[model samples]
Target: MAVITTKGVEKVYNPDKIPVKALKGVDLEIEAGEFTAIVGPSGSGKTTLLNIIGGLDRPTAGYVEVGGEDISQMSDNALIDFRKEHIGFVFQAYNLIPVLTARENVEFVMLLQNRSKAERHARADELLKAVGLEDKVHKRPAELSGGQQQRVAVARALAPKPTFILADEPTANLDSESTANLLDIMARLNQEEGVTFVFSTHDQRVIDRARRVVTLVDGKVDEDLRR
Candidate 1:
């Protein structure tokens, strides 16, 4: 079954006034464990589409189904619960809490899920190690480098054992080497853990790594290519 599906999805900011249509009749599907990248120039609808798919925003028209469930039909509270259980996110900003240690930041998500303290700690530790940050577990975001912080963010995103990960310009802040390392880690996780990865990126490095690339132009899908 398709893990993510969109049917004629449309997102308009202003209905009465000049409507800024961000996503226009977008229909797509993402299979489980697929590493898909939505590539486009700035002002394209890539991020908007990603946001809709991840339940960060609602479409003005049409529908989005994730993991066989129609999110458009869910209540706001139910969508929030669905997100907590099914979706993971990584942003270019890292978005890690400055005061929390790397491991603590990862554990925080599990804590929110009401996971046992021991289970949270163990899972967080394992994820940190998986992201190659075992030594930096005790270090706060300020103490870590940009790449290390992103790794911590990745671990935090994965702490809940989420079914899919949605990353937006994840490599935009990283240097070439750091981008390589981060993408390698995520790619390996996709292969090994069967975690679906969908990213919105303009970076050529990210495009090269994607198994399938969906090109967006002016809020519409222009091309879908498989490598």
Candidate 2:
């Protein structure tokens, strides 16, 4: 099943002023459980496309369907709620709360959903273990290594049981070993738990691990190769 679908997607910034066309007519589909990488040069609109698909930003024109819902047509508040329920985001910056422990950070999203305290704690523990951070559960972001912090970020993203994960340069800050470990964890999750992942990355390490590579150039899909 196609978990994510984009048709004729376009993004234009400052349309009334100096317009910057970030994306132009992008058509793509990502099936469930696929490990896909959206790769391109700096100006290739990879981030723009990811943002649109993830509902973080709306497109100038196009249709975006995530988990079969037309997110492009949703209101800002609606989009926000939709994202919380369906999309998981992992940024390059390991955006964890500096004050919260790994377990607390993982429970944050479920808290937003008004989940029971017991449910929240249980899920957090389960995810922290899944990411190999069971021992670091009580540690704060500042107390963990860069790799461990990213692992916590992953666990947090997965806390909501999102339909798919959208990661933007998730390995940009990690060392080689950290990147490898993170990738191994993600690949295992995809295979073992049937998680779906879509990444916008420039790292060759990430590209090498992706089962499908979609290349974009000058705001359009230049090549799409599936391994």
Candidate 3:
């Protein structure tokens, strides 16, 4: 099943004045249970496409559909609610709340969804343990190592049981060991639980781990390779 679809997607900045075309009529289909990486040099529209697919930004033209719903036409408020329910985001920066412990940070989104406190606690503990942060569940972001913090971010992303995980430069800040460990956890999840993941990354470590690589250049998909 195709989890995400983009047809003739285009994104332009300052279209009336000095125009910057970030994406030029790009089309893509990302299937369920795939570990895919969108990779390219700087200014290749990788992040732009990611933002569009994740519903963080709207396209200037064309349409985007996720989980069979056309999100391109959704109002800003609707997009926010749609994203909250369907998309899980991980960025290069660990975006965990510094004031919250790992478990609380993981539970934060479920709290927004008005999940019961017991349900939130149970899910947070399960996710933190899944990401190998069981022992650090009570530690705040500031008290954890960089890798541990990223683990918490992953746990938080999974807390919502999103249709797919969208990650941008997720391993950029991690050391070799941490990156490897994080990749291992994600890969295991993808394999065992059939969780889908889509990432935009410049890291070779990340690219090597991806089962599919889609290369973007000059705002278009230059290559799509599956291993």
Please, what is the TM-score per model? 0.97, 0.98, 0.98
What is the C-alpha lDDT profile of model 3 across 41-119, one tens digit per residue? 9999999999999999999999999989999999999999898899888989989898999999999989988999999
- Screening candidate 1 with a backbone cut-off below 3 angstroms (N, C-alpha, C), the clashing residue pairs are none
Worst 10-residue stretch by lDDT in candidate 2? 83-92
Better of 1 and 2 by lDDT: 2
- Model 1, C-alpha of 140: deviation from truth (Å): 1.1
lDDT ranking of the models? 2, 3, 1
lDDT of each: 0.92, 0.94, 0.93
Flag regions of model 3 displaced more than 4 Å: none
Lowest summed lDDT across 10 adjacent residues in model 3 is found at: 187-196
Model 1, 1-227: lDDT tens digits are 68999999999988899989888899999999999999998988998999999998999999999988899878899988888899999998999999999989999878889999999989998999998999988999999999999999888888898889999999999999999999999999999899999999999999999999999999999999988
Q: How well does candidate 1 score on lDDT at residue 87?
A: 91
- TM-score of candidate 2 relative to the true fold: 0.98
Best by lDDT: 2
> Tens digits of per-residue lDDT for model 2 on 164-197?
9999999999999999999999999999878899
